[model samples]
Target: MADSLRESAVGQLLRLVNRQWLPYPDERPEFQLPDYDTPIDQEKPADHISSIGPDHQPKRRSEGEEQDVEAFQLAKTATAERTVSRTLTPIRTSDGIVLVDWYTLDDPENPHNWSSPKKLLVSFEICMYSFAVYFGSSVYTSSIDGIIERSGVGVVTASLGFALYVLAYGIGPMLWSPLSEIPSIGRNSIYIATFSIYVLLCIPEALVDNFAGLMVLRFLLGFFGSPCLATGAATFQDMYAMIKMPYLLAFWAGAVTLGPALAPVVAGFSVVAKSWHWFAWEMLWLSGPIWLLMLFLLPETSAPNILLRRARRLRYLTSKAQLKSQSEIDQAHMSAREVAFDALIKPWQINALDPAVLFSTVYTALVYGIFNSFFESFPLVYPIIYDFNLGESNSVFLSVIVALMIAMPTYCFYYYYWVEPKVAKHGFGPPEQRLIPALFACFLVPVGLFIFAWTTRSSVHWIVSIIGVLLDIPQFAASLFAANDFARSSVACGCILFAHPMFVSIGVPGGISLLGGLTILCAGGLYILYFFGANLRARSKFAAK
Candidate 1:
């Protein structure tokens, strides 16, 4: 094939026909033209054939003449005369270069062949950094009451400490995601730098004497730390191969589910043993060393960064002289600036304008709102009822921890291994698989809510009340995972997925906190209602009814 392509007269003519616009395919194999404007190489255009001469000179004036002319044309321009001008070769793009893969896989630079240690390293780092961001968001659960008393801020204003952090969670990822697209600012660096800023921001909350200062610092910390939570999944998607993606996502999803569970435990110590100010101080102290360790241990997990390094190193090892620098590589297909802009705007815009995006965002956010609200309500619910001591206030969260350990794995098995495959087999988009987790959540959330709520009493044995609380965990975790899958699959860039927790954290409490007077009864009823609504929606989608 190579000799025929190289030596054929037709091949030489084809090369001559394209001129310098198409480079020699065997060596400098690039088309020096825009992607859309590049000449179609797959076939000869009818007009082109005519212009080039005999290939498609058409027929004659009459039937006999037409047949004779066709035969002559076919004879004159046989495949033997023509040769494929451009040789098949692969090139890299800035996107692919940084990611250590060819934008086109046949390039041999694909990351799929990366060592197992490297892939595992990237996955672990994503999990921990994601965990760190969640920690910043909810770690203050124990300190809210104390901060209010010491700072003299009203409950509504102080809640902003956490609210603003979560708000950043929504807002931060939007910008940071684009920022990470830059080959220079690796995702690992982004995690380290922003998380470091987060810890410092917390210091003021611990040390500051004024409410204004606390709010300002809290917001600042969140503003800086926002990317960790916001960009986690995208980071995950970029690293793991497709086959491992679901299970990897499941593991990270577990961290996300578990982050809140462990938060109360951290806060419990702060509230039970120390001043709220000191608690802040302690968290600040703790975050610094942890971040330092993360910085030292977590390598750059961003695909682009990995590729950029590999491309640079490979350039040195081989004689492939035209190894274009990262920016120079993909600029033909998309400039860094253009790529970043699209990455930033497309997700939010699609969610607002596209029904699938909006529906997924709305459903997941609503369900997630229910789950996260449970996290936000610790101070109010725990302190008042059960007359629980400081640490005991955080005990309510234990139910969640226990339940998630059970529920998350079960949902994992059902989604990645079962429902998802069924969806694929049936021609449903990945979002369709999300609907199944909804079934699990719908069944579990209400049952736990009613059990926990009605079971609550000074005399009914706190463990029984705790059981209801415990059951709520898996239900929420399962629902949350489902909602996330839907949001990610439906939204462009999975950007709306970024809002899942933000919307949930605020929405759940915004409604549920109002009904703490009937906490168990109301919560149970609400979970059941949402789950029921979710199931109906899922069935409707499946049945297309």
Candidate 2:
């Protein structure tokens, strides 16, 4: 009887151990490992919870030998369900697929998945805004005489206003570009806010009685109107896939070039018909419609921003504690100072230290400086030598527009048919390949500058000098566009800043001749890049990618 009592006690102990240490049959299925070879159609509950949840909290374990299996299983199941409830409520298809991206595959919130018509509309508005803002920057050049007379500033001092405006805008992007990338303040918001401020500032700029006030207002206008220069290309990247970007970017380039080309014509007539203030009013009128279009039409295109908004909405609706966007989650540990340093300081460092960036910047800067200098020199050449009025002098810039119209389409055909096909069949060619067209075009810049410099005399037909400008502008535009494609944002902006000072120092024919000589040196640099860019990129840590 004592032995039988002992056996019963042992059996009870064994049963108790099994119940505590091992889960029940129902719970086994929940914790079972998935098939390793097969694809997971449905995201497991645990996997979904872990991805979106806050960091797992530490729990204290009991030191006692015995534990409650039923309680543990119940707790785990509740935790998983709560996680599911709080995080992204993924759509599960009848075929067991889980869709957990920021939006449904066809969701309109994703810019990439936007309808073709919507994409076109947004692109058109962005291009138009870019055109208008750039036009505003250059229109003042046409009113230099008015500015000189009204402000009582010398011609050089009045020209300084334009130079400072360009410089300020170039630097402005260094700050605004980084800010626009933030989720809370996206591309659309930045564009809308700055462009509005830009439009308002134009009024003060127009009405300013002194050169100092005009200069200040001009600087502020450029500072506020910088988004189109800094972030416009990024917008295209955000909206379109790589396949469509070439054509879209080409179109954008054409629009941007058209701005400066058209500005002289429009402001020339406006200033002659009215006062210099009318030029500012013209800009205000043009910008007002652009501002409205952007406010209504431009959708937020940043992927991180969209995902962040979705995450916030889910958290609000579900009241889940740990739900976060991938960007938010990744950035959770980064300090504000670190973020600022990376965004603000790092770009300058890259521009300063990276050879590839330096070369590209130098090339583009040379082209830009020469192009802007034409504004000052064209009137000197055309009016005196050809006996033209301000309107006729301004009309000369039409050759640039014509050249752009011809060059853009031709380059697009070459890129789409020849260059892109090679890239497709083989791997990506070296960065040097981007400079091939630029190599040939760089030679034309010096040729055009020399031709225009020597031929701008009464003896030559007016067409000869215009032809010279025509050759240079198209070649410069084409080369700059190509180099820009390979350059970093900071590098491009820095180069633009460099151009402002170079163009401001006016010496007429002497300056033109100097620029022509400089073009020859720049052409040599282009050849070096064409031959050695690949090797340089391979060695550099921060080479263009």
Candidate 3:
């Protein structure tokens, strides 16, 4: 039965890939332009073929044999509207024909309407930005011992810096996400500005002489660097349709997961070869060019922002007072304080009150806290139990990356072939469908934790403990992805806030056992969501909006 299932899954995945590359044999032909070079009277209007009568005869043209210019223009406009109306918003032209809003259908400024290559390039850059910042967060873990030795702080105290940085980014997004969404400011501008400050803060973090200075700088670094984490997913909503979201988001989630997992490998080498401060230098060198690429190549993606620019240009040239984007018109009456409160404070209240958000927050928080605890526990378990060097100790994290590689494709296959087909058949089902991968993840989390907990004994092989760690990676990835997809951004902040205190109360081993138990409890919550999520969404005023 298992082998059969595996083969079926593989076949489904192949079909999915094939479909992406080549259309089905019976698919309708795409729209083609008419040969306008020939005089209007000499050529047949082939554009009207698709709109022919049921008898398979061409419809009579509104113009007689003289070839009416207005009739030809109307036919061309109608054809364009039919081709793009599903994806782009249509606005009536002065000639009584429709074109896409702000600009024509093929406008490069509209992120959603951009070419696939352009969208992929932007997604790649944003994922790189996310990877760089998250890498900085965990690279510090390998340097914890160096930090303790140099600053005369205990392991617990040094660990606080990591905890605080995580907490800061979680909270920082509440402030930054709102700012980034403003039509005048926009996604790319916030990315460039905050990221520049974030990189500059790293220098002081490396050079700081005291523990207090280190903590302060680390907190600021996370705070300034948070836009990538907070608003990165929102960029996808701007760029892709719902059907393509899962795959693109999986790529993004992979990059986010890889950053921390890959960090320790590099940091371990840096610590042994040079010093802990070298990790900081490494981050600086790596992140600088990413920032530059974003500044130069990443365009403004927010639709309101693009339209606002167009509105401004139209107002300048034509002096029309009524020409304004929906965002501008909506914000015209509200003060900045009102806008901020609605954007920032309202989301928090909704997240707090909503059952879906609360459950997702708890699950994501537990996963995040456990992942952080690994940094503290690994040194104790790997080096002391297995007698491995720093590099080998760090290489254990590669297992997490391997697990992620396996998990993402498997989830993609299941999602595309199984869940997506159901959704397509039924129309968008409950948000709980997003949690399907996460449900299995809940069981895996505990299974991995228990394995790690028992296998860390001196007699046990180190690979057993590594396997335990490996099991948690897919769960972590799945849970984070589900929560981000299903719950509000405020849930991310709540998870981070909750993670800091959890990590502080229990050291690594105790934390692992606690997380294992919590996973079982969270799994029950997932079951509730799976069964009742649609009903809850039905009752939610916020979900209605």
Candidate 4:
């Protein structure tokens, strides 16, 4: 009885950690075969082995892949037209390996097959997770004055705590994102573990008095909190249909936008009500519960990880040494040289060699850097010119979130009415079709900045400048995959490091107008890409043909 109790406790703990909703594949009666041994002789494992190249991994089929074209087409016709691609039949591969796959089209174990309510639950959880981390990034900005006064540091030195935090998270995904891709480690483990560390680090950050200690702790906080920022959309893609993705992603992107937008309001009031230490504590208050909720409910979402665990269970049950998932097979054959190149070199190569990638990276980095600059710029404008208190001054940031609310729904409407039908009829649209939204947004940014630049006087109504801030939210495809997360983020970090100093040197009017002019140039770049991007992609080796 005591042993059973102990075992029950251990099983519960495992369930909480893994949070995979279905039974282990080995434990299911359908998976157990009375005639399992009879089929063993008929399996031609060598044929499967010879088909795969040494360096080839089982990648998610791209739109360019022949086999996936029909699937993509079928996905658009109707809900009734959708069909499952993989089945329960064990595929024997090279070296006596049994490959594990979904039981059927409706297999609940497959994340894609999960019910709508369940998918929404997971989506909401991840969105909250993303919001908490991004909220941490700017919460410190409201407390910068407190830090400067207490530590006797200059404005720039105090702001480094915020700037370095941004840089650290950008650097972090280079390491953490790769670990999440490993089938055995998976997304949930990376998210929960790192977020736990992030939440705990907030305690130290809140308590630390020294400038150097505070800087280090802030950087650590951002580093540990980064996985969600980089991978949250990838999680959305794992379950949602491609046709349905823009709608869901619009919401996810809104969450990202609102995080920093809302941060100042909370931290601003908290700092004024109590001490600056409350800014750090507020992160814990926001994030600690989020971590607990994630621990209990956030299931492992990576399809590779789910199948890999299933393969392990099947191997143990059948007493077979070679039962594996495709991910496991790929992992086994991957060489150290390939790993290093994929992790370190490939993103830079694509960014450098592909014009489309370079354009998107530069455009998005400028947008983010300017957005980050607002954290510094807002206090300068509102408190000095408008005579608003810290909390009220910080509240101007609500305009960004207001803009986000408007922009997301607007994008969804455009995708549904404009983009979706064309894609449905044509199989998939050209890459330039994705840039249509950007064409509008790129032009809007310069207009918004110019309005903001000219309207900084007390004689001007604050709402006009706030309206300009509202319109400054630019839409672009951000780096979503684990492979390129670091590349995009690093560039954004560099821009962020430069943004504050540029604003300080030129003053807000000069600085804002300069950014406005830059966006006008970027707007011209967008127009060029819209017309010429296809030709650029055709010439590039990295781009899809």
Flag regions of model 4 displaced more than 4 Å: 1-12, 15-36, 40-77, 80-87, 474-504, 543-545
Clashing pairs in 4: none
- The predicted structure with the larger lDDT, 2 or 4, is 4
Q: lDDT tens digits, residues 1-545, model 2? A: 22111112232244357633332221243433222223443334332311332232211323320133223323332342211112223433333322223322234456665556666877897889888877877788888898878767666676766676667667777778889888767787788789889988877877877878787888788788878877887888887755457788778877777787788888888789888877788889889988866655566678777667656655554455444565665566678998999878777666676777667776776666656665557766777778888888899989877788777888899888888777656745676877787777777788888888778778879898788788787665543342232242233334333443443455455667887898899889889888887676676666543
- Reference-based lDDT, residue 360, model 1: 52
Clashing pairs in 2: none
- For residues 1-545, write the lDDT of model 4, one tens digit per residue: 22111122233376557644334544656664422233443323321211232233442333333444355335533564446543334444334555566555356667776667667878998989988888898888889899989999877778788777888888888777667777888887788788889999999998999999999998898899998876777788878777788777777777776777789998888898899899999999999998877776677778888888777766776787665678877877888788778866777888778877777777666656655654457777898899999999989888776777678778888888888888778856687888777777777778888899899888999999988887786342232222355545665556555666777789888888987887787789879889998888776778653
Better of 1 and 4 by lDDT: 4
Residue-level lDDT of model 3, residues 1-545, one tens digit each, is: 22111112233244457633322211224523222123222144322201122222233543432253333333332342313322222222222221113333344455655556677877998899999988887787788888889888776677766666776777677778888888887887688788989888878777777888888888888788888887888888887767568888888889888887888898888788898777787788778889877755676678877677666655554455545565665576678789878886787667666767766666666555555554456776677778888888999889977898788889899888887677656866656767677767778878898888777777877888888888888767644443332232234434433443454566455766776787777778789989887776677667666
What ranking of all candidate models by TM-score puts the best one first?
4, 2, 3, 1
CA-lDDT, candidates in order: 0.53, 0.66, 0.67, 0.72
**CA lDDT, candidate 4, residue 183:** 82
Error of 3 at 101 (Å): 3.2
Best by lDDT: 4
**lDDT at 184 for candidate 4?**
82
Report model 3's TM-score to 2 decimal places: 0.77
Ten residues in a row with the worst lDDT in model 2? 1-10
The true-versus-predicted C-alpha distance at residue 260 of model 3, in Å, is: 0.9
The candidate that wins on TM-score is 4
What is candidate 1's CA lDDT for residue 265? Answer: 74
